[model samples]
Target: MSVDPVEQWSGVLDRFEADIALAVSGGEPVPWNPPVEAEAGPLPEELADRARRILDAQLESMAMLGKVRNDALAHLDALSAVPDSQSSAGPLFLDVQG
Candidate 1:
């Protein structure tokens, strides 16, 4: 079976993102980083445009992730509201008078 081009591209981008994040977080050294050079070019205008697009895409992805998390949490809360016999035990009583 052949891999989808979009899936392949996404894997590459995910690796690039992880490497950048690691360098930024100090898990990897910044000085010898290769991504910096990969992004650098003599054409500043084109690079700037590409950077803006990448940032916009990343922001959208984050927003979608947040929405998914919120939806999942709301579902969990709704389920939690329904009391289960295993979870509904009587209040604790201490035998301090014994």
Candidate 2:
């Protein structure tokens, strides 16, 4: 099925927002804590790298969302300025006065 561009973009923004929330939560659902010094292995570089990427994605998503929101608001305002057919064209029949 074809998806509207705006709607598709909106979904992307939503996903990014969710990702940001999860990242901000410090990977609570999954164990995110770095391995302790006594641990045999060092912290996973992949985790740190993934976190950075997520942060970048979150920033980009926020910027896109802001632009899209502003554009939508502007479009709405412009649309509101146009008079409806009834208001612009008046009544079809004239009123007969006594």
Candidate 3:
């Protein structure tokens, strides 16, 4: 059975939201690869503008997530560079006497 365009777009948006949520929560992005079918004519003006806006927002969000991940990795790298003070202490044992 052929699916309606509205239904298809709705499903795609739903998946897009879910994937975005996963990415926001520090999980691997769940790819939403819907089948691409070519349309016979250009999209309506309003639909085209809405799609453009959504795409722009999605791209912006992805870029922000990438920055956050990169920043965290950089911070970890900086921390790893610091020498552990315990390593310099050379294994001391303490005993308590009553």
TM-scores for every candidate against the unseen true structure: 0.45, 0.45, 0.61
lDDT of 3 at 31: 50
Question: Model-by-model lDDT, in order?
Answer: 0.57, 0.59, 0.68
Q: Give the C-alpha miss distance for residue 86 in model 3, angstroms.
A: 3.7
Model 3, TM vs. native: 0.61
- For candidate 2, list the clashing residue pairs, or say none: none
lDDT of 1 by residue, 12-97 (tens): 45555665566444474335333343333233442455446556766765676678779999999999888775666864556889
- Best model per TM-score: 3
The list of candidate 3 runs beyond 4 A from truth reads: 36-46, 89-98
Best-to-worst order by lDDT is 3, 2, 1
What C-alpha lDDT, on a 0 to 100 scale, does residue 55 get in candidate 3?
76
1 or 2, greater by TM-score: 1
